[model samples]
Target: MAQPTYALIRFQEVGAAKVQTGLLVGDRVLALGEDINTLIRHWDTTEGQLDALAASVDGLTGLAVSDVEVLAPVEPVQVLQAGANYRKHVIDLAAAHRGPGEDEAEVRAKTAAMMDARAGEGTPYFFIGLPTAIASATDDLVLPAYSNSHDWELELAAVIGKEAFRVSPEEALEHVFGYTMVNDITTREYVFRKDMPEIGTDWYRAKNAPGFLPTGPLLLPAKFFGNPQDVQVTLKLNGKAMQDESTHDMIFGVAKLVSEASQIIPLRPGDLVLTGSPAGNGAHWGRLLKDGDVMEGTITGLGTQLIHCKDEEPTESGQQ
Candidate 1:
C-alpha cells in the first residue's frame, strides 16, 4: 500500500480518563495502536509504518469526530516561536511605532531594508513558550485580566520528529515529522515592560498564559504538506475575515527556522517551532479580543482551529 495522507489527532471518548491517538479521515477518526507520544518516540522508524497502517484501517470502524473531544495533537517538550518573520507584519509594526512626523514611505523603505539586512547578515529571532500554555483547537481562550490588549496571531507550526542539533538548512526539513496550526495569542500591553525600560519584550508574560496557544485540529505529515513555504494562512474573528496571507511572506522559511533553531538549541522529538504570523493581527485592526469573540484560523493542508474568547474571572488573589 502507498503512504496515506493522514492527519494525526488526539481525542478522548466520552467519560474517558486519558487521551488516545486517532487517524483522521473525512468525518471520522480511527483509533491508533498507540498514543502520539509513543509514535514520536520512534518516529524515525515508525512514520512509514503508521502511514501504511492508517491506509489499511477500516473507516467504518472509526468513531465519528463529533463523538469525541479533540485535544491538541502533541504536548511538545519545547515550543520555540519565531518572531517578526513575516515581512509585511514587521513593516506594519515598525510603521505604527515610528516617530511623529516620520514619512510613511520612509518608514516602509527603512523597514524593508532592515528586513533584507536581517535576512542576509542576521539570524531569526526565537522565543520559548511553556507546554502548559498549549490548548485544544476547540477550547475557549481566556483573555488575561492583567492585559487590556489581548491580540491574535495565527501561524503555522512545525513538529520535530527527530533529535536535531547544528543541522544545516539543506537537511533541516528531514527532521520535521509534521505540521499544524498555532494561534500565537499575545497581550500587546505585556509585550513591553514599562517598569524596566532597558529590558526588552517580555514574551514570557505576554504569550505563556494558560490556553494562549491554541493548536491543532490535526497534524499533517511533512511529506504530504509539500513545500511549507507556500501555504496560505487565514484567520477570521467573529465571522469577519481578518488575517489572510501566504507563507511566502515569511522572512525565514521552515528550513531556515529549523536549521537556525538547531544551531541555538537541541530540538528534541515532538518539539514545535512556530513560524511567525503574517499581517492582519488584532494590533493592525485596532481591535483586541473581547468576550464572546470567536477566532477561526486555518493553514493550508493542516486543517483549521476555532477558538472562543472569554474574560478570565478574577479571584481573591487576582490570579487567573
Candidate 2:
C-alpha cells in the first residue's frame, strides 16, 4: 500500500488574484497549477486523473508543492451551511429575537417549550449559496450597502473528494477529502425568522454577495483530525476573539451532516459542507460588520482565513 497523497494550494505571489494548486507528497509539495486543469479536462471529470497526478509528484522537478505559496484548495460550486448549530448560539438568538408569549410559555411548558424553542431556531438546518461568493484564503470581504446586519459564524467545512449520494452517516467518512475554515458570512436581518418559508426566498439576495465567504489556507486531510468531534473552533473580529467553542458542541456531527446533505443532492467531488458555527456570532452582540473590520476564523486541523472588510453598495430595497 502507498501513502495517500494530499492536494494543497496557494497564491502565485503577494497580492495575486487567483489561487494555484499543488500536491502534498511526503515533505515536498508539487505545484500542479495548469497541469491540474489540463488533467481534469482530459480525464473528463474522472477521479483517476487526480489520483494519478497526486501519485506522480515524485518525478516532477521545480514544480514542487513546497516551492509554492499555500492558499485555499478548492473553489467550490456551492457552500452549504447550518444556521445556529451551536447550543450557545441558540440561547443568544432566543434572547436577541425574543417576542411576547415566547418568554411567558418558557415556565409552564418545559418539554413543549424545548421542542418549540428549536422549531424556529434549531434542528439540522442547511442552505446553499453560489460558489462565486467564495473569497480567496487571503482576500478581503466586501460589505454591501443593503446589509445592516452582517455577521460571521466560524465553521469547519468538509470538502468532498468523491461523488456520493444516499450514503449512510457511518459511511460518510469515505467521501471526505479534508476540512477547511469558513466564515459563514450572513445578513442576519435578511434570513427569515426561523422555519419560515421565507428563508428560501432570502438565499439569492442575502447570501450571494461577492466575497461573502472567506474559506481556506489549505484543506487539511481527514486523517489530520482523528476525531472531528473533539476539535476546538473559534472566530475573531479585528483582534478580539468572539467565538470560542468546539465541534463537540455541534448539534449535528460531521457524518450526520454529510449523510443528510448527500441524501438530498448528489454531492459531487469538490463540493463543501460548512459544518455550522459556534455561539457568539456577531449578531448576538448587536454589532455587525463595518468597513475596515477584520475577520478571522480557525478550526483544529484546518488552517485559518483572515478577511479585511471593503465598503460597497448594497442592493436596493426591492432588488431581489
**lDDT (Cα, tens digit) per residue for candidate 1, span 1-320:** 45667788999998997889988877778888887867877877877776776776675758988899999999798999999999999999999889999998999999999998888888999989999999999999988777679999999999999888999999999899889999999988899899996999999989999999999988888888898988999999988989999999999989999999999889998899999989999899899999999998888987889898998898988676
Model 1, total clashes: 0
Candidate 2 residues 132-192, lDDT tens each?
8887767878788776688887788887767779899899978876777877788876766
Once model 2 is optimally superposed onto the true structure by TM-score, how far is the C-alpha of residue 78 displaced, in angstroms?
A: 3.5
Compute each candidate's TM-score over C-alphas.
0.95, 0.77
Best by lDDT: 1
Query: Best candidate, TM-score-wise?
Result: 1
User: lDDT for each of the candidates?
Assistant: 0.90, 0.70
Query: What's the number of clashes in each of the models?
Result: 0, 10
- Model 1 clash pairs? none
